[model samples]
Target chain A: MSANKSILVCRCAERGLVDTDGIAGGESVLVIPDLCRAVADGDPMLGGAFSEVHACHPRAVQSLFRFAGHPLPDTTQVIDCRCDGAGHAALGTMEDKPPAWYPVIDYDRCSSCGQCLEFCLFGVYEKAPDGRIRVVNPDQCKNNCPACARICPEAAIIFPKSVEVPINGAEIDDEAAVRANIRVNVDEILGDDVYAALRARKQKRKALLNRKKIERALEERRKCSGGDQ
Target chain B: MKMEKTGVHGIPSTLQERDSLRLRVETYADQQGLVPPLSMEELRDHALELAPSSVSVDYVMVLLNNAVWRETVASIPYERRLLLLPQCLRDFKNCPAEMDEFGLLCEECGRCNIGELQSLAEDLGYVVLVAEGSTVVTRLLDGGKVDAVIGVSCLNALEKSFPHMADGAIPGLAIPLNAGGCIDTTTDVEHVRNAIRLRSDASWVNQVDTARIREMVEGWFSAIEIDSMDTRTEQIAYEWVCGEGKRWRPYLLACTYDALSGADGIFPEKVRRLALAVECFHKASLIHDDIEDDDEVRYNAPTLHCQYGIPVALNAGDFLVGEGYRLIASVPSRTADLMRIAVENHRMLCVGQGEELRGLVDTPPFTAAQLIEIFRRKTAPAFGAALRLGALAAGGDDRLDAALRRFSESLGIAYQIHDDLEEYRSGEEHDLRASILLALANDQRPLEWYAPDSPNLDHVFREMMVEEKAAQLLEHYKNEAIRALNPLASAPLKSLLRRTTSKMLTPAGGRA
Candidate 1:
C-alpha cells in the first residue's frame, strides 16, 4: 500500500510508531503522536490527510474522527494498531487464535462455595443469570493467577497449560531445550516420580494430538473423494 | 446367587455410599462429643445407633472410629505424626527398591505413586514408614515416638490395626486402599496428602471472617458512624467511598494485622483506623485516576467526577487524602513512624502516577521490563503502605517493614501484569503506555507483524508468546514475594502471607 493512502499514528511518543526512515514510501506515512488528544480536539486537517488511519484502538479512533467533524472517506479503513511494533508489520498474515490459557471448573468437585467469585478482583468469575457461578470472563483471568484454585476447598478449578510460542526464528529444538530444562528442574525439586508423571502426561498429549491430526487428514481426503464422486 | 456390593474388605463399594456411611458415623460422633481413645465397644455402640439395621455394624464402627480420631490426629504436630503406607501399594513386580528395618526404601521409579507420596510426606516432616501390619505401628506408639498415625492400608489391614490403635490410645486416620490384592494396591494419594498436611494451627484461616471485617469497614463509611468523626467533607468523602467495591486494600491491611497479631483477641482499634486509612488513600487515588483517565464509570456506577463534576470530585478526593493522613496520625502508638511511612508511600504512588500520565503525552512501545518497572512504581507502594501500616499498628520493627516493602513490590508488579492480561482478554481499549502484551509482541515478534497494512492485529494479542512470557514473570514475582517471608520469624504470619500468595496466583489445578 502507498504511504499516502495509509496514515500511521503513534499514540506513544517514546517510540516512533514504526522505523519509517528505512522504507521506500516511509515519508508519506504520517507519524502523529498523541493521536487520541489530537482527534479529541477536533483537528480538522487530520481527517482530510489520509483515507486510512492506523492507530492502537480503531474504535476510539473512529469516535475521534466523528468528533472531528470530518466525513470518513469511502475507502477509509481504521486499522487497529493495538499490537506491538512487530505485530503491526505482520498483521494481515495473522490468523484468528484461541485464548492462550483459561480456567476450567470441574463441576463434580466444585461445591459452589463462591470463593473464586468473591476472591477474584477482576470480574473473571461471576454469578450467571441462572444463579450458578461460572467463569463468565475467561479472558479477564490473569493467565497465571490460580489464587481462586488454591483457596478452593474442593480443589475443583483447573487451568490449561500455557501455550508456548516460538520467539524470533527459534525452532522446535529451542522449545524442546526449554522443556528439557524444566524437566531437569522438576526432577531436582519434586523427585523422579513427578518428572516421570509429567513425561508420561506429555507423551499422552502428543499421542492425542497425532491422532487428531490423522483424523483431520482422513476427513479432508474423504471430502475430496466425495466431491469427485 | 446375587452378588453383594462391597469395598476392598466389605465396606461400601461406591464413593457416594462410603461418604454417606462416614457422614453418618461423624454425625453420631459429633453428637456424642467424642474424642479419640474411645473403647472399641463404645465406638461400635455409637456406629450401630447411627447405622441402619441393614448396614454392616463392623464397617460403621470402623468409620466412626476414624471420624472421631481425625481432629485429634490433625492437631498433632508433623514431627509426632507417623505416615504408615502399606507395602502392597508398591509395584512389587517392577520393584528394585530395598527395605530397611523400618520398611521399604522407595527407589522412586514412578511406576506407582509410592515414591511421590513418600517424598512429599517426608518433606512435611512426617516419619513415613512404608510397611504393613499393625504390630510395627503399635510398637512405634508404645515407644511414644508417634502421637498420631495417618495409615494407608487395605480394609482388612485397617480393621486389624484398629484394636492396636485403640489399645495404644493413638489418634489415627485410616485411608482404606481401593483394592485388596496383597502384592499391589491403590489408594488415593490426595487423601493421604491432605491427611498428612492437615493441622489445627492453620484453623486461623477459617477464623478470620473476611465478610465480617468487610462489614466493619463498610460501617466506618456510614453517615451515622462518620457523623461524630467529621461533618461536611467527611460526609462527601463517605458518599464516594460508600460505593460498592471489593475493598481489597482494607482487607489486605486487616489480614496482615490479623496474621501478625492472632485473630483470637479483639482487633486493635488503631489497626482498624489504619485499615480505613488505606481505603481512604485507595479511594482518593481512584477518584483522581478516573478524572485523569476520563473514565465515566466505576463499580458499575458513575464515577465521582461524572456524578458530581470534576471540581466537586477533585475536592472530595483531596478531602479523602487529608482524611487518610488524619487517620494515620490518630494511631495511638508510633504516630510519627506511621506518618513517615504513609508520606513516603504516598509520594512514591504520586511519582508512579505522574510517570504514567507523562507517558500518555507521548506513548511509547514499552518493553516488558519497562512496563513492570512502571507497575512497581504505581502499584507496589499502595500495597506496601497497607502492609507496613498493619505491621506498624501491631508493633512491628524496621526489619518487618523492609521485608513487607519487598514483598509488596513483587506482589504489586505481578498484580498489575495480571490486570494487563485481564484487560487484553476482555478486548477492552488498549492502554498502550504500560501494556506488557504490546511490549512483549514488539520485542519478540518480527517487524513485519507491525506493518501498517496488516489485516488483523488480533493475532498479536492471541499469540501465546507474550502471555507465556508474562506468566513466567508473574510466577517469578510471586516466588519473590514468598521468598521475602524467609526473614519472618512468626510462622503464622509467614504461613498467612504464603497462603495469600497462593490465593492470588494459583490457578485452578495449577501447581500448589
Candidate 2:
C-alpha cells in the first residue's frame, strides 16, 4: 500500500487508450507514445521494472509485462488513466475500459492435456502440431471469468484481472483448487445451472463476479479443514 | 484516424467480394465437416488456407463460424432466433430509434438499414436486439428463451461473443462490418437479409406444451409452500419442500405422465398427489443427508438441521416420509399398486444410504464398483419411482416400468457420480470421507490415500488423470441411460427421455 513516485505512462494514443495530458510530466515520470507498440517492438526502455505504472487497466499492463518476459512483481501498482490522467495528486482506476481481458497460461503447470481447449467455447486456446496447448486468442477471453482455471485440474490458467486468488496469480491451496467433495462441487455449479434451466447454464457460471467472498470462504474452509483433520 | 462512413475499410470491402468469400468458406467448411466450438487457432489456420491473402483472419473466422452453423441456424425457427444489429449501423444523427432493456426500438426511419433489418427480422418473428455488447443476448440465451442468433458486429465484438454461442452449442451466424469505424460501421445488407430469411423444413420441432406444464407444476408447488398448515411440523415440512429445489422429481413425474398418456392440458388431481409424494420422499432424504453430512448449507441457504436442531429436523424428515406414503395412498383405487412402488423405492433408498451411512462404523475404503452399487440403491430408485408413478398413473404397462427402472439406474448413478465429483470439489461437509477421484487415482498409481485437504492429493489427482477417468465413467453411465430408453415402445416417453438426457446433463457435461 505504499506509493512509488517513479511511474511510466503509456499514452496508448493509437487506440485512444489514455489521455494525452492525463499526467503532468515530472523528472521521474516517463511518457511513451504507446506502451503496446513499445512492448511489441521490444523497446529497451522496458528493460527495467517500475513500481508504479500509469496505463490502461492494471491487468492489461501486467499481461503486457508477462507476455514480454518481464512479469511485474506483485508489489507494483498499476493505475488506469484512460478516463482521467494519473495526475501526481490523483491516480484513479480506469472507469471506462476497452476489450483487453484475456487469459495467461503458466506453461510450467500446463500438461497439454487439452482440457482447457475442449472446455473453452471462444477458441481462446489452441493445440500445436507438437501437442502443446497455447493461448491463441487472449483477447477473446471473457472479462473476469476464470472458469478454465476452475476446471484446469492443474490450476495453470490465470485471469490477470480476476478477483479470486490462484485465478488472479496468487498461490493455490485447498480452498481454490480443492472442493468439499468432487460430487458436491459438481453439484453446486451444475445445480445452480439447473435452477436456470431456461438459460445457458455454464454461461451463468462464467460471469459470476462476486468471487472474492466465495474464494475467501474457501481459503478459511481449507485452513479449518486442515486443522480439524 | 477515423475512416469515412460506409467507404474505407479492409477485407472484402465490396458487397460482391464479401458474398463470394462467404461462398468459398461455405464450400471449404463443407469439405472439412468442421464443427464448432472451433478454436481460434483452428479457425485462423483454416481461414488462412482457404481465403485469399488479402482477407483478414478476423473476417474469415466470422465467415467460418457462420458457414458451420448455417444449417443449424436454419433449422431453428425464427421465433426462437434473434437478429442482433449494432447501433453503429444506424445513421445516429438522423436515426429515430429508442432503446429498451431488450434492444433498440426502431422507428422505421429511412436513414439507416437498422430500421430495414429490424422490420424484416421482426416480421419473421425473430427477436431483434439493436444494441451494443451482448449482456441482453447472454441473458436471453441463459433463460432458454432463444435458441439461435444472427448478428452483425465488428470483429472485436464477435470475437468476444463467439465462445458463449459455441460453448452452449447454440447455433449462430455473425457478419463482420467491412466499412467505416465504430461510430457508423457498415456491413453487407445482403448478408443480413439472407440470414434473417433463413428457413428450412427442419426449422422447428413440434412438441407438447412443456412450458405450460412446467408453469403448472411451479404454480402448484408454490401454493402448497404457503398453504395454511395446522401443525408446526407440517409447516416445516412444506417450507422445506418448496425451498431451493428444481422440483426435478415432481417435474419428471409430470413429464412421464404426459409422455405416457399424451395429456396436453392441466394434469388430473390423482397425478398431482402422486407427484407430491415423489417430492416428499426426495426432500426427506435431503434433511437426513444434511444431518449425516453435517453440511451447514444447502440450496444456498441453511440446511434443515442448521435452521432447526438435528432432532426436530430428523422428525420433520420422518414426517415427510410418512406423508409420502400417505399421499400415495390418498387415492384408494390404485393405493395398492402405487404403495408398492413407493414402499419399494423407499426401501431401496434406505438400503443405499445404509451402505454409505454404514451404521455408525468407521470410514471404510470403497472400491469404484462398490461405490457405484451404492449409487444404484441410493440415487436411482427415487428417479425410477418418479417415472414409474407417472407411467402407472397414465395406465402404462409393467414393460414400460422395466425400461424406466433401467433408465433411472443409469441416470441416478450418473447423477450420483456427478454429485459425487461436485461435492468433492465443493469441499462441503460429508460423513462419507471417500472420493471416486481418490479411488480412481489409487487404482491407477497404487498410492496411499491422502487426506482430502492435502495439496499433494490434488497434484496426484491431476497427474493420474483423476477427472478424465471419472468423466469417462460419467459419460459411460449417461450413454447407458440413453440406451435404456431404446426398449420402450411408447413414442412420447422415448422422445421425452431422449431430450431429458441432453437437457439435464448437457451443461459443462462434455458430450452429453
Best by TM-score: 2
Q: How many backbone clashes are present in model 2? A: 38
Give the per-residue lDDT digits (tens) of candidate 1, residues A1-229.
4345665554433222322333232555666544533543355557565766665344344434543456455577776544334423322211232222345555545677676675454567887767666766655654334445544555455542211221111122453444442212222332333223323433444466566669889999999999999
The candidate 1 chain B region of ten consecutive residues with least summed lDDT is B1-10
For model 2, what is the error of residue B152's alpha carbon versus the real structure, in angstroms, after optimal superposition? 6.8
Clashes of each: 28, 38
**Fraction of the true interface contacts (Cα pairs closer than 8 Å across chains) found in each model:** 0.00, 0.00
* Residue A165, candidate 2: alpha-carbon lDDT: 55
Model 2, docking class = incorrect
Q: Interface Cα RMSD for candidate 2?
A: 11.7
Give the whole-model CA lDDT for all candidates, comma-separated: 0.64, 0.70
Q: Model 1, B74-111: lDDT tens per residue? A: 66677656677877677756776654333465666688
Error of 1 at B424 (Å): 2.0
